[model samples]
Target: MSEQIEDRNVARAGRLDTATLSDAMDRLGIVGQCRAIKPRDAGFRMAGRAFTILYGPAASPPGTVGDFIDDVPPGHVIVLDNGGRTDATVWGDIMTEIAHRRGIAGTVIDGINRDVHLCLSLGYPVFSRDNWMRTGKDRVQVEATNVPVNIGDVRVAPSDILRGDADGLVSIPRGHEERILAAAEEIEAAENAIRKAVAGGMRLDEARAQYRYHQLQTRAEGAKP
Candidate 1:
């Protein structure tokens, strides 16, 4: 996708919540939900295209954790795949501060991060398995960047859109994001109509029936996304 188009999608994602997007994905038979990747703060939220990093056990006389941050484009999310290791953290206070200052959207780790307080204080969104103080300095090394990586059992490729909210994070495959956004918007509008109907003295069941609530997230076909 062009940079301009990606920017538009990211902005659109910022307006929608994860739950609604998940429902859209469900209707579309798409799988992009990142399991176990909870937000560090319930109030935290993020939306951006991914800049993925793949990690592995360090090598003998391990290479320096590459200075990848400086190259990350502003408004892009830093996606770290650490094999879900919690013993050593790949992110910390310094990283959080830098990311916030650099205009980076957020960070999501399949593993753990450090400096929870800093992230919370900066209001910088971070979705990870957990937080710890132990550094991954010599324990893990970057195996690759901008490559496909497994996050919460979901394969997230570079440039994929990810959104996180109080509930959790979900990756929207780049190839299907536009359609997903359209579907989500449609579902959200129907839900709003349902709410308005309920408030206007309509029976709850009738309101739901009018908007087809039960079938809103149900797909007409078993075709996979």
Candidate 2:
């Protein structure tokens, strides 16, 4: 995508919540809803392109955990895939402090993270299966960076836009971002209209029917959403 288009879409996505985007993905027959992964703090929010990192078991004499932080661009989320290991944490307070200072959008881990207080205090979003204090240093090593990785059963590639909120996180594939954004905007508009209609005392059923709410996310078989 061109820089201008990416900027516009990212800005638009920043204004939306994960719920609406999930609905859009459903309508478009795309699977972007991340399951199980949740925000460290309920108030935390983030939207940014992904900078993926993959992790795997360490070998004898174990490799270094990583020195990849400095390479991430601002406004890009750090995605760490540890194959859902909860016994060790791939992130901690130090990473959070640096990421926050560097303007990194947030960090999403397929495993767990330590130092919850620092992340919460810094107001930096960190989404993962859960949090714990055990370090992943020697247990896992950086397998690769900027490669495709899985999160909550969904495959996320580099540059995929991730939006996290109180509910959870949802990813927008770079290939289908434009269509998903447009669909999500449409869904949001209709929902907003429903709220206004109800506020004006219109019957709930009538408002839904008038706005085609029932079919908004119903995928049309074999057609693009």
Candidate 3:
């Protein structure tokens, strides 16, 4: 029975599309929207499940935020939900190194992060609202790991499909990964056909009309004369 549960979890995580993940982010209206770090050198491509970390102001002691970094697993992104505070830094240089060494996919914070140069130099992916040199202990702490966390009005659970690029970051609910991916693939195909039509000397208006780019109007009109 335990094995079956484990298998089910694995199957669920694997439902996401490796290629269409980014595209889905774009189609779903969640892409390239993260605030870029100064001297922007932080970005990476990773495929795996998500491991979330929750945070709060009174969550931990002073000078000990690194302790939370120890709990992350390999092939998982350390998503930190710091209640959207842009004042303190929840991530830093040492923490970045440790996370990378542990095979962590990346780090996403709903707050500020420090050590921008170090993280970028290490080729570790980090997504946050802003960057700063302030330490986390002064204003933030890791309250829990692999738990639900609120990020920008969204509650993210562990093992969700997280795909982000220069555009922005997005969390795809685990159960909806397969369906969303299938939808994104179909959307891509439809757009590609439209592009080909335009490239074949068809006027922009003609292409748009041929593809019914305004499908809404057709639906509404079908109910009329």
Candidate 4:
């Protein structure tokens, strides 16, 4: 996508309501769930600017991450694309400390991460495929930051809103931000009505029908009059 389109997507993501955001995530079927590596137990609060970190044997040369940090805005997330490798860690204690000191929001790795004790103690949010003790030396290197990278079968550009917690991570595309949020809001409203109906002694199936779930499906399917 064009940079302009990407920028607009980011702008829309900035306006997402937290509740609706969560709802959208729940409705979607595992679109952007960050693999393993539970987030710190400090409660789920979205932070981070926007940075994409890529790590792999085919990754770019060394010092790429440093250049990325110097270029990207502060509070950005470091999205690591390690080709889904869980053997070598892309980010560890030292990188975590450096990223935190740089005011970055968090790190999202498509590979594994290490130094769990230090990462947890330091309270830096991390989403990864696995947790390992082996470090990325000549095995993998920082390809680039703030560049386009693929994570979980999706192409993630810079500035995408990445929200994570004990549940997992959700990577929102820049373009679909507003539409997804709107759909999520509507879904929540429909679910709330159903919730109230069930509390009023309505049967589950009856409440669902009354809420027009079938009608919504028909409309979604472009049913004829």
Candidate 5:
């Protein structure tokens, strides 16, 4: 993606919530919602490009887990894919402290996290399947970075836009960001119009009809919203 396009999409994405994005993906026939992945705190929210990390079972000799935080760019959310393992944690207090100090946007793990108190106290967002106390040091090892990985059942690629909130996380593919954002904006606008109409005493059915509410999330031909 061009720098200009990325900036534009990122800015637009910041204004959107996961609910709208998920509806947009549905309309576009894209599966972007990360199932079962939720924010640790209901009030936590984050939006940024993705810095992906893939983790796998540790080697027989127990290879190093990883020390990739130093390389993660500020304002990018660290996305860890541990194959949805919840027994051990790949993130901890020290990493949270450094990530917060470095201006990192947030962290999303398909597996789990430890030392969540640091995240809460620092006001840093950490979204994942769950939180556990066991460390993953010798249980798992970093397999790759900036590569495609699965979070829930969604595919997340490097640089993909991630918008996470109390609801959950949604990974917006870089190539489809523009279309997805446009669709979400349209959906939001329609919903707002419906709300306004209803508030003005119009019948709910009439308001929905005026906004084509039923068709708002219906998949269109050519997958164009």
Candidate 6:
């Protein structure tokens, strides 16, 4: 059952954009949108299962910052929760190069990242609260891995589907992925039909009316579509 679900999630991750997924989440009353977290480059896009990491203040000796990259599986997103600290960076050029070479999907941070030029040049997606030159090496340490973490204001668990594009990133809970994907697919189809109608000379209002645009993301009782 778990395998089947994972497969479904992979399929959804490949096809859905963050906007549609956000709508689906809203319809389902799920708060998966990561506020204030955005791509280092607006052109960068990524989709993958999350490999979560939680961060905390460094101990007296100052623990390591990014050794976890070596163990992350390919196609898994590295979600770093740095407590929304923008003063220090949890990622940089070397990590970008390594993550790109390893086929890792991308990195999303609640803090900031330095050396973003490398990511832009290499096309390795890195999303964060902001970018800075300050190093997080001795300021923060890995608290845990494959653990539940907060990004923006959303709670993300290990293996949750993460989708990011020009707009921003959103985390879809694994358990609700199937339902969310279904609603997103429906919403996309409706929007497409509206677009088609508009292209075929129908008024924008008429097209939206025909497609019931306002209700596409309306929250339903019990989270039913």
TM, every model: 0.97, 0.98, 0.74, 0.72, 0.96, 0.95
Q: Which wins on lDDT, candidate 3 or candidate 4?
A: 4
lDDT of 4 by residue, 36-80 (tens): 534544453454435787765734443332335555565677788
Query: Candidate 2 residues 155-210, lDDT tens each?
Result: 99999999999999999999999989999999999999999999999999999999
TM-score of 6: 0.95
Error of 5 at 104 (Å): 0.9
Candidate 3 deviant stretches above 4 angstroms: 1-47, 59-63, 215-225
Q: Give each model's clash number.
A: 0, 0, 6, 8, 0, 0
TM-score of 2: 0.98
On TM-score, the stronger of 2 and 3 is 2
Residue 203 displacement (Å), model 3? 2.3
| Native RMSD of candidate 5 (Å) | 1.5
Looking at model 5, which ten-residue stretch has the lowest summed lDDT? 216-225
lDDT of 5 by residue, 82-166 (tens): 9999999999999999999999999999999999888999999999999999999889999998999999889999999999998
Angstrom error at residue 95, model 2: 0.6
Off by over 4 Å in 6: 2-8
The residue-by-residue lDDT of candidate 1 on 58-156, one tens digit each, is 999986555799989999999999999989999998889999999999999999998899999999999999998998988999999899999999999
Model 3 deviation from native, Cα RMSD in Å: 6.1
| Model 6 worst lDDT window (10 residues) | 1-10
Clash pairs, model 3 backbone: 31-167, 31-168, 32-167, 32-168, 33-167, 33-168
Clashing pairs in 1: none
Against the true structure, candidate 4 reaches a TM-score of 0.72
- lDDT value for model 3: 0.63
- Candidate 5 segments whose C-alpha is farther than 4 A from its true place: none
